[model samples]
Target: METELDIEEESDDAVLGSYEEPVRLVDDAAAEILILWATNQPVVWKQNFFVRQTSLSFSLDACGQIFTIIQSPSAMVKPGVTGAVLWDSGVVLAKFLEHAVDTKRLHLLGKKVVELGSGCGLVGCVAALLGASVILTDLPDRLKLLKKNVDANVGIPVTTRGYVKVLELTWGDELDPHFINPFPDFVVGSDVIYSEDAVVDLLQTLSQLSGSHTTIFLAGELRNEAVLEFFLEAALEEFQIGCIDQKRWHPEYRSCRVALFVLVKKSLSCM
Candidate 1:
């Protein structure tokens, strides 16, 4: 039986610390320019829904172009909600995807991909930009902001080979057939294993969404070692796991505070 755990709320400062990089917004007549410490390049925020003070922008350099993702910092304060802000793990994982493709270690072109707990949709957007059809999923409440970011980044230049769509996915709920009919070639997530209560359900959902041939990539902040260990222990029961070496991460976007892993369902014959 699954049990609920009482998770401590993260303080405002703790939440803001996720983005260790310095950030400043510059005002422009037509749009706001976000200057991120890592990528000194200014990301221009469109005036549509991105003009609010709560909106923040970050960039990912991938597929020979830059992808800008908009996040809502204000949304993070909602009770038990962490999906509104862009976390460092998301950045690390997204950049790792780019590095893997560039190094010919991974192939995503024309493949189907899914992102679990796709907060801010950074990793999924990067996957789409890398030519993979991607579905970005999270809780129903998270879809609003998730879709907003996807719409702003995924098809901007119309040069990507694959497309991206957003959907509501509550971990452990009975998944819609559309999500598993064609088992995704790759499942990616970042900062998803923060709470113990969600670990079991997350593993359950992962098991259902993956096939023997599917590969799962996850990254998380190292703030909670016990929860992460618990997740890994539980996940091993259904999948083969491996830690991705930091050496293989994107050259410029690496972090000691984030850990990345790759998992695959164990073949039934082997099991």
Candidate 2:
């Protein structure tokens, strides 16, 4: 007797539980970048045909800060070196985090945070600025650039106010207890949900890093709906998923192509 809409609502409730409300935290400029990427436009990149090394600057209005990221030229980036470049979703997420903290929608002060697939370490740096101890992780080869950006923006061996550390984390590998014993209060990722082959591993890593009190924020460009759907299906098994409303952020950042999800550990009963 359930209508399609009823069934859909029930399914969403089952997967999302009490966190069904959308929290807006994206801007229109960020939204436009995602749209361009979805349409195969080169708005974020410098060269049309090839990737080019470039320096880019992002402004955090809430804190009146600017981050300069050095992007490796596409020519120098070999296979499996995608993390050398900054992506639009990363920028969007960084901006959203800044907006969230400014508006008091999310608290990062005195919290431990981890960023997965932290290309260029922009989001991690922003987290540090917002008063969260941050661990930025990517593949081993990508650590150099990631560390450079983090150090350049956040300084080395940061103090108790907020610290930033770079680590090599290959998805699906056994998590190190030393790095995650207490579990971070918040986990963040940007443009990480691309490969169909990597989705399972990515979800596994997320599950391992999350505790009952942990919340995860993931922002990804909608390149392939099927791939995104696959990730959501797998993620639902371990976490309660909520979509953050575009309206919660600056009007300039809302995008039809860029999506943000907030994930929390599912209750034991639900599990």
Candidate 3:
């Protein structure tokens, strides 16, 4: 029988992803800062009860180099602005990719990857750094920030092995020819399943983009059991699903708050 957390276990780092030495921001409002490990880059924010942050940065260890991804944060008060802010699920997924590639467990070299809901573009950037030609997609409104980050981190000096591009992709809409002509080797998303109403649309897009050979990896925060369960039930009909236990994740990056999954076409898995 298929299970959500079905992957085999592997040893991983013990610490939650480490941070570098704290660096204070220029403004007096700067209170607490968390630095990414390896590169002592600081992520600073105001000292308020509800911190209002402008930008967030993370340093990841991958490709024998430290890669930094900078993100612009948007307030939730805005009607449709969740994509601009960084989320824990995205971080966990990005770090997992880094660790998996670094450890020689998941080979991304020369593969084509598509990241759904590429908010802040973290996972997509890391994939490029690991040698996967990647397309980062989201709504048209989210493209500007996604493109900016892709150009900054996945360009020449930082990622020469692979390439990254940004395109607008809505959940239920028709996919562009680029996504269908050469189906992606892997499709990925972090926190893409949040609402019950969007599940069918997301499944539609996933079905159209994947082939028998395509693999899908998704990470999400377990915010609502009903929504997640609904997605899982709907997805299982078309794909073979397996869950990656926290033990199999990057030691320091694994979290009970987030869940990671692996999916493959049912036809391929049944063979």
Candidate 4:
């Protein structure tokens, strides 16, 4: 008893249900070259490939002010070159900080903030924009690009407020007088927890930089459960740890595979 209209409707429904989104394969190297050309930045030829700049935009608030960061291209397996590029966890943490400030959950206005492993300084730039006096730190080789990005994005000091500085910090090294004399009110790290061999050194550095009143925020990709567990196990000795709820972050930035943690020095009473 089915009419032609009924049959056509059924066919349409089946077609729609079976439809799949198309996937586009991209040549990463070629795309980097194109991006470099469009941005008018000089390109370097290395090992039969082009090294170029990558531009990223981060929103500072609901008012639509954005921070732009320029960074060199990076390779996943390249030795000693990870800090030249941007990473997803950095973007997520930047967005999370913006969200937190917008909601008044965490106040950064006029606070002293330090960012560890500030690869391209995206998170630190965003923090500076949010009114925190920020110190961006990384290895010696990485400081050049980090400073470039910070200078380009943050610009000159504004009326003695929201200043940004770049410093070299090697994990487990002797504590510098500047880092120890005035502990940062806040310590932040994005995607700095991947290396198992460096965890102890990192913890030592963090302990040296943090105090009872200092708050620490760490955002990292949950790629290896055992590595993360090892960090948490070691960190528990000094810090009281809690994970930020993923639902509280901007929906666009929410990643089930990425986690943000808030840590505070454990009080003797609580320990």
Q: Rank candidates, TM-score, best first.
A: 2, 1, 3, 4
What are the lDDT figures for the candidates, one per model?
Answer: 0.69, 0.69, 0.69, 0.66
Winner by lDDT between candidate 4 and candidate 3 = 3
**Per-model C-alpha RMSD:** 13.9, 7.2, 11.4, 16.3
Off by over 4 Å in 1: 1-55, 156-161, 268-271
> Candidate 4 residues 1-271, lDDT tens each?
3111111233321100001111111123234224324432222312211112343332333224655566566443477676676666777788888887877767788888889999888888888888888889999878887888888778768226667889999989987787767777789998888877878998998888875457778887655556777787788776655556566576676654566776666552242
Number of backbone collisions per candidate: 0, 16, 10, 0
Highest TM-score against the true fold, candidate: 2
Runs of candidate 2 with Cα error greater than 4 angstroms are 1-62, 75-77, 157-159, 268-271
Better of 3 and 4 by TM-score: 3
Task: Decide which is better by TM-score, 2 or 3.
Answer: 2
User: What is the clash count of model 4?
Assistant: 0
Weakest lDDT window of 10 consecutive positions for candidate 4: 14-23
lDDT of 2 by residue, 161-228 (tens): 76788889999999987458888888999889988789989998988897755778898876666677
TM-score, each model?
0.77, 0.78, 0.76, 0.74
| Candidate 4 residue pairs in clash (backbone atoms < 3 Å) | none
Q: Residue-wise lDDT of candidate 1 within 1-271, one digit each (tens)?
A: 2111111245211101111111121112112111121232212322222113355876656767777777788776788888887777888888888888887777888888889999888888888888888989999888988888888877643345666778899999998987887888888999889788999889999889886457778887666446766776677666655556577789887765666777666553243
